[model samples]
Target: MQLKQELIQQIQSIIATAKERAIRSVDTERVLMYWQIGQVIQEEEQQGKERAGYGEFLIKSLSETLQPQFGSGFSVRQLEMCRQFYRTFPNTNALRSQFSWTHYRTLIRIENQDKREFYIAEAAKNNWTARQLERQVNSQLFERLLLSNDVKEVLAVARDEKQPSDAKEIIKDPMVLEFLGLKREAAYYEKDLEAAIITHLQEFLLEIGNGFSFVARQKRIHIEGDEFSIDLVFYNRLLQCFVLFEIKTTKLTHQDIGQLQMYVNYYDRFEKQEFENPTIGILLCADKNDAVVKITLPENNKTIIASKYQLYLPTEQQLIDEVKKEIEKLDHDKMNE
Candidate 1:
């Protein structure tokens, strides 16, 4: 009976693998066809000496002819999209087979060449589905990372040109938790938030960035006669260290940093192995003051980080405000120096 069950499972796995490969093959062919269409349209459009009007007429006429026989996939908008796709990724040889037509459409809409390239490398490296790619774009993941690091470092890390040396490289600040279904207006305790995170662990892990895996929550430890609980703990494969998180429902204070520092110290002294890197401490607070954090931690501190959390994704104005704050902080630091 056991042997029969094992044989059935093996057959099921083989069938599933074949089905997935077949889907990927079809998607690859469709992507290639669109790129070819785009190439032809682009060549013909360039041949017309006329400006804007000629390109529009050509695309519209082609769409009308193709839609009748080939269906709505050849609509004017789609043709325009294909044209843009080819223009964005001019080299046919450079087009990634892993990306579907939807992925190409999303990438084509991004006007910035460098940003597009970063997303392309990251999407390919991470094997992000079309919807996952779209969510990251919509959530402004790239811009959020840029809030602390510069474009050069961001792109280099994504392209594997440089390995991440700091937690800030991989962990995003002001993490958006709109996926938790927690209402922005509603107040949540640290425990409630922790429960929500446990429920939506997958999305939380995705938003937290790469190379992280969950370890424990409310991890209790006793030091001599005293007892303490750590909110959350994770292991980062890339950094090769244990990440300790302490959640705060209100604004971060010096005490919060000190407590988290204690947790980090405990892990480093007792939990960490000699082969592993130092444990990293992170405070997921509703709000945090940069000045307070800077004052609390030593200038050479690398293991401690305080990140703000938001229930909802920020609006355009909110991002602008955050950028302004970053600039002001830089100016303030320079002046203090």
Candidate 2:
């Protein structure tokens, strides 16, 4: 009976694996077929003597002809997308097999080549589904990273051509917490915000950037009969350090900075192993004044970071403003030096 059960389990595993492989094979072939159709359409369009609106006419006619034969996938919009896909990825070798048509559709919408490539590399490395990839794109992960570092170097790290040596590479300044289901206008306590983060811990981790795993919540520590409870604790494998987070529902102040710094010192002194890097502390706040943060921390400080959390996504103008502020802060720091 035991031998029979084992045989059945092994056969089931084999069937499941084979089915997954077959689906992947079909998807890959379908992607290639679309690419080929796109190529033919582009070639014929280029050869046409009539230049004005000829391409549009061609796509429309082709969509009408193919829709009857190939069904809804050959709609005008899809055909146009396929054409744009070929234009964006001129070389067939550059197309990644792991990406489905939906993934490419999202990728092609990105106007910046470097940003597009970065997302592709990151999505592939992280094994993000189409929906996940779309979310990352909408959140403007590339733009947020560029807020604190050189674009060229950041792109290099995204491509895995270089490794991150500091926490800045793994952290975003203003994290979007739209998934937390919180209202911006609603008054909430620090503990409430912390609870939301804990409830949506997976999304929070993803928003915090990669390589982080949740450790503890309201972690208790004692010093000289005084008790302190840290809001959240995480371990970052890439940085090989314990990442501590303090939740602040209101605007950040010097006291908040000092508290986070103290927590960081405690971790480094007692919790962190000598082989690991120093613990990094983050104050996740609703608002922060950059000047106050700069004045509070030591001139050479790298341990504590204060980042704002937003309940909703920022508009394009808001993103631009954020970037400008970041650049100005960097300039101000340079001048102070």
List where candidate 2 sits over 4 angstroms from the true fold. 1-7, 333-337
User: For candidate 1, lDDT tens digit of each residue in 197-249?
Assistant: 99999888889888889999999999999999999999998899999989888
lDDT of each: 0.90, 0.89
| Per-candidate TM-score against the hidden true structure | 0.95, 0.95
Count clashing residue pairs per candidate.
Answer: 0, 0
Q: For candidate 2, lDDT tens digit of each residue in 124-169?
A: 8888888889988898888888888787877777788877788898
Q: Please list the residue runs of candidate 1 whose C-alpha ends up more than 4 Å from where it truly belongs after superposition.
A: 1-3
RMSD of 2: 1.8
